[model samples]
Target: MTDWQVHALKYADRNSRTRAESFIFDDNHDAPHAMDYFIWVLRRGAEVILVDCGYDSEEATRRGRPILRDPRDALAGIGLKAEDITQLIVTHLHYDHAGGLHLFPNATIHLQEAEMAYATGPCMCHDTLKMPFTADHVCEAVKRVFQGRCVFHDGDAEVSEGVTVHCLGGHSRGLQAVRVRTEAGWLCLASDATHFYENVFENKPFPIVVDLQNMLDGFARLHELASDRSLIIPGHDPLVTTLFPQDGPEFCWRLDRGPSGDFNL
Candidate 1:
């Protein structure tokens, strides 16, 4: 199998009060949750595949989420420039995950067909379901489709050698997760399917779910896809930085290698 280097770039983080009842579907009192924002990069030889374009500083300010640094700058820290990337996988159309679409001008954006429909379809007519998406970001994706830069996948599809995307509608109507073959083994990048390790480990669903059953099932699918529990990476957990060894001073962690320390499974 062809192996690739996986890197997680953390762009911003926020601390919020969350209860186990809200996040886990179980009754538990208040707990502090660290919501970290990140974009992933996969590299093999000279090929680069980016996953989830992180939101820009303006969106951060408007949303009241402080920016640690621009996601583009975070990519630069790992020796990559936005324009140089030719392929990107969009987990979903949420503003924080897809807002930076304009940054990668020349890249082919891969997304789930259902996601595009969900973002532009009747569900968006309600403000509650549309809160996570920025109109401009969704509109730009439509433009990309017209420009021949968007590739919509019906379900599971291979992005490159050893890298595959699986559509698992849970948090959104078309959310997907990426599985990549790494030096360690097959690592499942459980994007929003499982926002934190606890979500999967404890069988707790996040509060902002569109389909609760699908979200629970997605967790099972992640376990089935990954080589092992430790190889599965969550979407917005601070423990990712602590468990995985840092590549440098910036928030880059090399996912191709084994985790630096033990974490409760």
Candidate 2:
């Protein structure tokens, strides 16, 4: 079995977020909470798979979240160009996740079946439900589908030998999580499944949930997927950068090596 090397690359973040927006019905909802945006890279030899594409500059401008570094440049730092990516695992269709679909023209996209339906289906008609998604990004996926570059998974399926995706819909109707075989063991990239360590450890749901129960269940699943909590990577936690061995505070953090030290809630 090939041990996949995984790296979490942070491109942007929002320091103005509040706990109220992160957890539901929490007493400290008014306290400050921050979020770091990232796209994970998985590679071992010639196989290179991208987890999610961070949002583009336009989305950053509209959402009031500025990009600290272009995700493309971040990938460049790791010696990968856009064309070098051949497989893309889209956990969901949220703007921040799928917004950069155009950035990688050569990669075949892997996604959950229900996610496409939820994005293009009746559920997207609701403003609140559609807020996290951008029409352009969804359409980009649609375009890839038309070009025969998209692969849909009904539930749990393996995209490659040591890489698999599991549908853990909570934040979105068809949201999924990625599991990879790394040096430490089976590592779970708990994308929106658990936005932060607190979301799972504290059992608090992120405010933007389609199925609250699914989100909660996914947390338990995350634990089951990884050998230890340190092997599980949250989708947007700033603590990630500090907890792992990385070159800097706002760049790539190696996930396959496990955490450098202990972390508490």
Candidate 3:
């Protein structure tokens, strides 16, 4: 059995009004609203895995991102430094999820090859698609690839025992999610495969989705993969803290319980 723990590394928070302008639907004029950027960590045994790397404080400031603190600082609250991480998984290449990668220099990162190609490919000609990414961030990711720290999977691949990555392209071409065996059963991490729980619950696709049909299909797959709805977690929902119990000394909010009664704290 594999044990896991989850930690929230909040890098930024945006007011609802700011994010609503571009994201929320309104019969009236486009009103702006804000959202938050969070990175998560999964720990199993002596191995520490990070789900995403939020933007660095400086990068966020330069980009005019309304942030609360550096993601590294949040990690520090848990007594972990960047180097402490052994593995990193980027569900996709969106800026909010892939920003603070530079902070972890010693990790071997897992990613979908299609995602890397898409982010650096011709599809970027579309402004809507390009808006979610920062060129510098992608470039930095490329550097990591050359440095031999990047691991690209073709489609579905298991990086560890009972931890599997599945292809569920929708919001992005190579968007993927994670499924791990736990004491409670199977837990699926629907990372950006369906941003908020509302998207899946209401069957409303995020307007920014690359393919509407795939988004719907992904939701179905997620439900099938998760033994129970309560075991499924959305990428950016604020409700995770309420649904799971905190288990570590710092920043340890676990997502699932292992066969040995260990949890993803």
Whose lDDT is greatest here? Answer: 2
- lDDT per residue (tens digit) for residues 105-140 in model 2: 998999999999999998888999999999999999
Point out the worst 10-residue segment of candidate 1 by lDDT: 20-29
lDDT of 1 by residue, 100-127 (tens): 9998899899999999999999998888
Global lDDT scores for all candidate models: 0.89, 0.91, 0.75
| Superior by TM-score: candidate 1 or candidate 3 | 1
For residue 138, model 1's alpha carbon misses the true position, in angstroms, by 0.4
Best-fitting candidate, measured by TM-score? 2
Residue ranges of candidate 3 with Cα displaced over 4 Å: 18-34, 246-252, 257-265
Reference-based TM-score, model 1: 0.96
Worst 10 residues of 2 by lDDT: 241-250
Model 2: which residue pairs collide?
none
Segments of candidate 1 deviating more than 4 angstroms: 20-22
lDDT of 3 by residue, 12-103 (tens): 66665433333335343355434445677776777777788877767777777756767777788777898898788888888888887778
Ranking by TM-score: 2, 1, 3
- Please say which candidate is ahead in TM-score: 1 or 2: 2
TM-score of each: 0.96, 0.97, 0.86
